[model samples]
Target: MIHSALEFLTQELNSFIKLKVGDPITNRVVLSSVTNEQGIAIPDQSLGLSLINIEEERTSKDQQNRFINAVGKVEKRNPDIQLNLYVLITANFQNRLPNNSSDDYVEGLKQLSYAVAFFQSKSVFTQENSPSLAGFDGDLKKIFVELYSYSFEQLYNFWSVVGAKYLPSVLYKVRTIRVQENAIQQSGDPIEKIYLESRHKP
Candidate 1:
C-alpha cells in the first residue's frame, strides 16, 4: 500500500508537470532520492520524490472487533496498522545558468512553487480522483496530503545527514494509510448468555 500510494502521487505530479511545461521539456519527474551515495548530481533537471520518514498513527487505537463466521463463532483477527508517510519532493536543477543569468535558480524555484500549488489545489487523493490507486488490490481507500514544515535547524540537520546540499524542495505528509490482512487468527464459540440459579431451603 505504501509503495502504491507513493507511485500514484509521483505519477499524478508528473502528469501535471508535463501539462504545465509542454513538450519542450521532457518529463523528468522521478521517484528517487535527491542525492546519490557518491554525491553526484541526479543526472538531469528532475523533480525527485523520496520517502524520508514513516510514522504509525498513534492517536487512535485499532479498535476493530473480531469477525463472526457463518457458524456464529467469534473469529479473532489482527488489528489494522495505520501509518503516515512523509515524502520530500526536491527540484534538482543545475547550479549555474547560461549567460551568467540566474535561470537555473529561477527554474528550480518555479518548479518547487508549481509542486506546492499542485498539492494545494488538490490535496485529497481517492479512487474517484486517481484511477491508478483505485486499481490497487483493495489496499488503498484514500490519502490526504498536506504540507509539512521544518525548522531551519531541522532542515539543515536533515540535509547534512543525507549528505546533500539543500535544494528547492517541499515536504508533504500523506495521512492514513491502512494495512490489514483481515485473516482470522483464532476461532471461539460465542457465549449466548449467563444464567444464575439459587435454591432456598425453608
Candidate 2:
C-alpha cells in the first residue's frame, strides 16, 4: 500500500509538470533519495521523492477483529493498521551550463513550486479516479495529501541528520495507508434472530 501510494503521487505529479513545462523527453519527478547509500548526491536534474518517516494513525485504529464473511459466517482477523507517511520531494537539478547562462538552482526552485501547486490542486486521490493505483482492488480506498511544514529547529535537525545540504524541498503528510492480512483466526455461525418472551408471575 505504501509503495502504491508513493508511486501514484510521483507519476501524477510528474505528468502535471510535463503538461505545464511542455517537456516530454525528461521526467520532472522521480522516486529517489536526496543522497545515495554512499552519501553521494544523485546527479539527476529531477525532483526526488523520498519517504522520510512513517507513523501510525492511532485515531483511526480499530480493535474489532470479528466480522461476517461473504459466506455469512463470523470470522475473526486482526484489524487493519492505518499509517501516515511523510514524503519529502527535493529538487536535484545541477548547474549544467558552461557559461552560466541559466541557473539550475533557480530552475530547481521553479520545479519545486510546480510540485506545491500540483498537490494544492489535487490533494485527494482515490482508486476510482486514479485506477492505476497498484493492487487497490478493495481494502485501500483513499489517499489524502497535505502539506507538512516544519519549524526552524526541526528543519535544522532533519538536514543535519540526513547529512546533506538543503535543497529546494517540500514535505507532505500522506494519510491512511491500511494494512491487513487475509488469514482468519476463527469462524462461527452468526445468530439468526433473537426472540423475546413474556413471563407471568403466579
Candidate 3:
C-alpha cells in the first residue's frame, strides 16, 4: 500500500508538471532516493520523490479485534496499523549547457514550484477525484498531503545524515496508510445471551 500510494503520487505530479511545462521531458518526476548506497547522487535534472521516514498514526490505532462479517459470523483479526509517511521532493539540476548554464538551475526551481502548486490546488486525493487510484487493488480510500517545515538546524542534520548536499527540496507528510492482514485469527458464532436460567433449586 505504501509503495502504491507513493507511486501514484509520483505519476500524478509528473503529469501535472508536464502539462504546465510542456517540455517533452519523459518522467520529469520520479519515485527515487536522492542517493545510492555509495552515497552518490542518483537523479539529475529531475524531481526525486523519496520516503524519508515513517511514523505510526497512534490516534487511529484499532483496538477491537472482533468484527461481524457479511454472512453474520463473528471473526477476529489483529488491529490494523496506520502509518504516516514523510517524503522529500528534491530537485537536482546542473549547469550542463555551456551557452545556457543557468537554465538548468532556473528550470529546477520552476519544476519545484509547480510541484508545490499542484499539491496546494488539491491536498486531498480520493478515488472519485483521482480515478487512476482505482487501478490499485486495495481499500486505500483516501490520502492527505500537507507541507512539512523544518528548522535550519533540523534541515542541516537531515542532510548530514543522508550524506548529501542540500538541493531545492520540500517535505510533505502523507497521512494514514493502513496495513492489515486478511487472514482471520479466529471465528465464532455471535453471542446471543449473557446468562441462562436455573430451573431447579440449589
Candidate 4:
C-alpha cells in the first residue's frame, strides 16, 4: 500500500469540505464539500485528470505513432510505471452576459475536461447537458468533474469510449503523468478513500 493513501488524503480531508491529497505523486486526491477555484465541487482526483492538448501539431500520423510507440517501449521496460497525458489552457475569454462578457478564470480547467471527453469520441452539441459514466462504481463526482472539464481534441465533434466511459468533444487544459500501478491509480483508488459516493452511499 502507498504510504500516502492512508496518510495524506485520509488525514487532510476528514472534514466536510477539503482538498485532500492521498498520493500527490500519483495525482490521487479527494474533494469533499469542497469547491474548486471555480466554486465547483472538485470531487476526487481521477475526475481532476490533467488534460493533454490534441491540437494540430503536424506530428504526422506516423510521427504520432512513433511517440506512442516510444511511450509503450518505456512502459515495457518498467511495467510498474503507467504513463498518461494532461492538457491545460491559459487563455481568458468572455461570454456575453447581461452586463458584459464575464471571464471565468476556471475556464481553463473546464475547457480541458471537454477536450479529454471529446478525444474519447463524445460530443456535447446534441444537448446543453453532460453525459454520465453509466454507474461504474467509482467516484461519480470526480468523473462528473472530468465530464465538465477538457478542450476540443479534434474537428467535426463526435463521441466515443475512453477508459470506461462515453465522452463528448471539447477543449481543455492538459498534462501528462507516470506512476506505479501499485500506487494510487486515481483519486479514490484502492487502499485510499477518494470515493465520495462511497462515503454517502446507502
lDDT values for all models: 0.82, 0.84, 0.87, 0.27
Compose the digit string of candidate 1's lDDT tens values, residues 36-114. Answer: 7677345456778889999999888678768788889999988888999999988877765466433377777887787
Clashing pairs counted in every model:
0, 0, 0, 49
After best superposition, candidate 3 residue 52: deviation in angstroms? 0.5
Question: Residue 20's C-alpha lDDT in candidate 4?
Answer: 26
lDDT of 2: 0.84
Candidate 4 global lDDT: 0.27
At residue 172, candidate 1 shows an lDDT of 96
Which residue pairs collide, candidate 3? none
- Expressed as tens digits, the lDDT of each residue in 1-202 for candidate 4 is 1222212222222221122223234422232222234532333222322233333212222221111232233112223222222222122222323434222334434543433434355321111232222122122212111223533553223223122222212333211122333232223212333555535556
Q: Which one is best on TM-score?
A: 3
Where does candidate 2 clash, by residue pair?
none
Off by over 4 Å in 3: 23-25, 38-40, 101-103, 198-202
lDDT per residue (tens digit) for residues 1-202 in model 2? 7877888788889889999889866777887777766762545567889998999999878999999988899998999889999999988766766556234888888989999999999898888877766453356689999999999898889888889877778899999888887689989999889999999999
Instruction: Report the Cα lDDT for residue 64, model 4.
Output: 14
Model 2 TM-score is 0.88
Instruction: Using lDDT, give the best candidate's number.
Output: 3
Question: Model 4: runs farther than 4 Å from truth?
Answer: 1-50, 53-78, 82-84, 90-92, 104-176, 183-202
